[model samples]
Target: MDALLSLSNDLAAAVERVRGAVVAVNARPRLPSTGVHWRPGIIVTADHTVRSDEDITIIAPDGRTVAASLVARDPGTDLAVLRVHDTDLPLADLGDPGSLKVGHIVLAVGHGPRVSWGVVSALGGRWRTWRGGEIDQLMRLDLTLYPGFSGGPLVDVKGRVVGINTSGLSRQLELAIPVSTVTRVADELIDKGHVSRGFLGVGLQPARLPEAFRRRLTGASEIGLLVVNVQPDGPAAKAGVLLGDVLVALDGAPVGATEDVQAVVGARRAGSTVTATILRAGAPAEVSMTVGERPSRRR
Candidate 1:
């Protein structure tokens, strides 16, 4: 009975410690404001949490509420950072997401007053958002997350944040982007004011070149992405990339699949030029294209 009491006390203390750093951010869209302690008086949340509004507040540890502003946001990863004018607020310690492994025990903290238990289900899980047509690597957890849980913290046993709870696929499957990915993109957003990524204005399809075409094309592959249509006056069109051209490589890396091209361009900075090798008219040729801004629809 004494040991049970002691363990209960320890658990209570741990919850208190996390709650101290956890804050209820009164953001638009009503997502659960799990808290973040990145810097003095600074907190991080999901980009979608505060993207559509201006007035925001952070519910502090001592039951104090303060106004805050959206510091930065990266739409690609759906992460955002917030800053409070006051400097005395407690900050949460960020854990290295690389340390997270599948089957590791995790605690999902949200605005409600308790930490929920779950286990990491998958790593490097890729999926596309309903709004943004891009692939984001996600960490799946075995928790039945709620709507307000978006942007909350996924902590380890020690109460260190390993990832930010982003979205859910089912009642039992929760998803999050690793904190390391958020940190990387957040750093860029802090410095550049936006997530810069390369874009090629062309819709592609997988195809096999005819035997005669393959014979003349040195780099043509029967199992690579082929350009079905190029957007008029867009990056690929401006670079003289024509329809039916087979994309062989980008920046010296082979692109065998449609996702490969998307991944390469999606990771590149906008306005930067990249070399693309293409099989055009049964001949291998190189083209230079300035990565353009992707349209909001991603079409």
Candidate 2:
């Protein structure tokens, strides 16, 4: 009984410690999500929750409503940054998400200072989100993300934010974007006003190579991506990649699927270059292709 009481008190104290950094984000029409004061005057929220690019506002912890401007948004990672002025809300005390172990006690600190306790259910290495964002790490939690909690902070026992809670990333599982990823994305968004991803303009489909060709390309996979369409003047076309070329590998990594292509391109910046190994008419060749920025589209 004594242990239970102590634990309860500690959780409540944690909520109190993090309350000031949590704010109510009103960017969507109906449902308002939460936001955290990640840095001074910088609020981070879930990108999906920010339905409007203009006329956005946030309700601070003290019930003071303030106007916020949409700074930049990265839908691939489901994170958005908003800028506020003339507010003195406390910034989040962040902890290392890498230190989290399975079954470690965690808290979701949301707007209105709502709290839900849970454990770190699982951890995974580098992964790409369905929307093509490269996440540094995967942090899953066994907690209920209450309404308006999508952009809240996932706090540790010491009241330090370890991640940002979001329901927008997955349909079946609750996920928290780890602190390292959040900081990296947030910094990029703040600096460039948009996250940049390397792109190669080409339509490709998986094609199984002939046994003889597979043997020739010793380091590549049996299946390679066959170039069906090459955008005119695009990265691939500019690099002298012709149609009917089967891409065997990118930078020595065998790419059997589109995800594999993304894994390589996304890791590199727009101005960087990648080594593309291809089989042109059953003959292996390599092309040095400079990566291009993926053209931004209106959401």
Stretches > 4 Å off in candidate 2:
none
What would the per-residue lDDT of candidate 2 be over residues 1-299, giving only the tens digit for each residue?
99999888888888888999999999999888999999999999999999999999999999989999999999999999999998899889999887899999999988998888899999999999998898998888999999889999999888889999999999888899999899999999999887888899989999998999988877788899999999999999999999899999998989999889989997888889899999998899999999998877766
Candidate 1: worst-modelled 10 consecutive residues by lDDT? 127-136
Cα deviation of 106 in candidate 1 (Å)? 1.2
lDDT of 1: 0.72
- Candidate 1 residue pairs that clash: 32-148, 37-92
Model 2 root mean square deviation, Cα atoms = 1.4
**Candidate 1 lDDT by residue in tens digits, 147-187:** 56777788776778777786633235577777667677667
Best by lDDT: 2
TM-score to native of every candidate shown: 0.77, 0.96
Pairs that clash in candidate 2: none
Q: What are the candidates' C-alpha RMSDs?
A: 4.1, 1.4
